[model samples]
Target: MSTDLEVRFKNIYPGKYFLSFSKEDLNTYLKFRSWLPGEEVIDGIEKAGESNMNCVLRVRTNERSFIIKQARPWVEKYPQIDAPVERNAVETRYLGLMGEDVELKIQTPELIGSDTDNFILVINDLGGEPFSFLYEHNSKLTGEDCKSMMAYISRLHQLKPVNFPENMAMRVLNHEHIFHFPFIEDNGFKLDDIQSGLEGISWIYKRDKVLKQKIESLGKLYLGEGKALIHGDYYPGSWLKTELGFRVIDPEFSHIGHPEFDLGIMIAHLLMTGHSEEIIPAMSRYSSEQAVDNELIAGFAGTEILRRLLGVAQLPLKLNLENKKALLDQASDWILSGMIRHE
Candidate 1:
């Protein structure tokens, strides 16, 4: 990120790129340049990931282009503070562990570089590539692709959780308080909106009367019965398509939750994107009564993410919806009714 290089890059790709890069981009690269003693001109910064604060730059030295990812924790110039950047480093390590089983395929760029603090991961950004956010097209996922995603979950689950770090449970859940962020109310431990969406199974937090008590109860059940590493954020944006098949990305939220937590939420996202509600049956292929059991996941997701959208961790889906009051109303209504009718 030399001064000259940054200026030149700005001039070259100056218009609306996928994500924007700025003067600070130069500072990150320069710091890495000094740290790497002999590393020659870290390649120019071209935008990579879908996130605004994420910068995917090319690191060229010996006739090779290495992808460098600079992920800042806070929302860029956002109104409120955001998630920690250290989570990106956690994701890098999580992917490495997962790669041991999946071989990572070619779908993921090589994880050749990293700066643990700010989460600057250098990879091989294939030009003929689209990230996961772009891949969850309307019913674009087929039976095989669906199975592939499911199988990956099963395999990760099969990995003896005992083999992980000593404090495996806490490490997996990380105790990060995501469910409460976007909500405007301060109603104790229960997320009023998330709790409101339960179609039938409503004895969650109230069964214990105390959130810590409820969390302890859920923790016991989750650890005792549920047997998988659930991707806390398994919505459409967490995977990608490669020459061979599909590969998942963004394991930062790799928490140990109910498997349906991942599956149902994904199906919910598909429906949100206007996929035929009839495709709801497709969810069953993953597990027994998956659609019903995981319903809470989507129910919670629509409610929770909607809050995030209204808060700080907004996604492109919000922009796509374009602040339309009608769509927002429909989303809110969808959560309450639990009916996803194809538009």
Candidate 2:
């Protein structure tokens, strides 16, 4: 009784193969791929964390533990939403390229092995918790923490690899959510379900033609190519607080694009989580070889804020209706003015 996903995955390999949560099934598949030694015995299997795009599992063996990730034809968090399975290939390429830099290599997980045909990746489990706690009310990211986060991204942008994956599918999907869907008048996503009076607050921006035009322009910039390598989904969720230090994961949405997209995402999250005080200092800490366009960063940051507040990919925000409206107002100002006003 194999599901369509299991059947399709099996066809890609010789033996019966499909990633599952079952310990026995994972052990057999790992052994077949030589990812696990024949003698190794599976001790347990558990979910790694909250992942949106892929099935991520932490496989603990008698000797060692590692992570197994597989990308299917749909988003793992929301299966009805279709996505590209080849996104894993992009992540594999990003990891390979990052490994070339000493600083970046230290901050990223070691790529144990990969089966591109099955869209699976195996990497050493960097035991840690994601910085998702920042989403809680009144939570704050320390100065040192902000510094480390900025340092990793700055180093990552320094990479100048030739012929990177275009990642057009992921980009298109992201483009719709970030730049288009949330602004649509009747998109069917009920904002009031997330927060009372949120739907009313959202209408202000949805109807603003000037703001939408600016956002459309920024979206075009996002789809275009740039010289720097950006960690496409560079936020707290992808950042891990390990015993060693801060480690970054899930570069599946990565591409050669504007570095401000990453910085803007970071700024947006900081502002959303009540870390406004950290924004200016954090921006000061970010050191890029090329000049960063602050206005572009502001536009992207504002767009990210709107998308999170109004779109399907919601955060664990504890803001009240008033706070949300204020944020929306600020976001609109940032977008319309092309400036980040921290007053």
Candidate 3:
């Protein structure tokens, strides 16, 4: 039978309409879900996190609350940056994949409901305390937290790569942001606008022809097909601290690729955040089931640091320009040295 709400949703352009939602819009969206309480009004709905590619919100009622995430064609913060709408579906599949594993579920969020037509996903809201800010002050992470994160990555990598075409789109997008744009001599990212003197830090890497060529080679390796499933964007921003513990979020960039890319990116963030002391310990805790190429991992780590320092995605760091430059120099050393040994 035809209904008023059904007709309403049919008219609401799923892509553009849901960009910023109201309580009424959310109510209409959840009309068909069994979890929604009958005859009860929604209390409030608000955005949950800061994201450049998706709209993440928390919808609440007297009965319960859940997170609603929808991916858009362009970055929310920087509209010029184009991203695939299908990446949200890839994230849903990734959550489904991890949900299948008993241990992995402990370290990840559960998928509750999803609307593929709108590229929106509903998942259990793991309260909004992101560990990314911990990097701002050199906060120490417990051994257990470090171990759980790396172990989760290791477990995911152990799984054979599945055929998911949507993930490839994210991988290509990630490759461009992480490898290509950051090194361009005049690629047009105004780093100083993000922070005073930030642009000066990139002068060395941006002008170095040799470093650019080396980075291009790393980009090629990133584009190569591999067998392990990887959390393509395994950085501080994706890690959340909840009542349960540390839960990894945002696998929209997940893909079948070299496991080292994940490990490298982890170390890259560590080095940039002034947590290099923890690098060896974190690597040791990973204890991958498969053999890992240490040099390749170092190269990936260097590239990630380079990108974060100069690329469109910037981290909130409380470091002086001198310190930022020092980190950049260290990242260059890692890139040129191409060696990371736990021993």
Please state the error at residue 314 of candidate 1 in Å: 4.5
lDDT of each: 0.47, 0.88, 0.78
- What is the full ranking by lDDT, best candidate first? 2, 3, 1
Choose the strongest candidate by lDDT. 2
Could you give candidate 3's per-residue lDDT for residues 1-343 as a string of tens digits?
Answer: 1244334434544434453466776776677565475876678988787776777888888887788888766666655566788888889888998899988887888999877777888899888588877767757777777877878888888887457553767778888888898887788778888888878767888988877788899899888877688888888889997777778999988878899999999888877776778888778777666899887888898788778878987788777788777777777777778875322
Q: In terms of TM-score, how similar is model 1 to the real structure?
A: 0.58
Among all candidates shown, the one with the greatest TM-score: 2
Looking at candidate 2, what is the lDDT of residue 29? 86
In candidate 2, how many Å is residue 84 off?
0.5
| Candidate 2: C-alpha lDDT | 0.88
Q: TM-scores of the models, in the given order? A: 0.58, 0.95, 0.90
| Candidate 1 residue 141 C-alpha distance from true site, Å | 3.7
Error of 1 at 317 (Å): 4.9
Q: lDDT tens digits, residues 275-338, model 2?
A: 8888998888888899999899999999999999999889998878998888988988888888
lDDT of 3: 0.78
Residue 315, model 2: Cα distance from true site in angstroms: 0.4
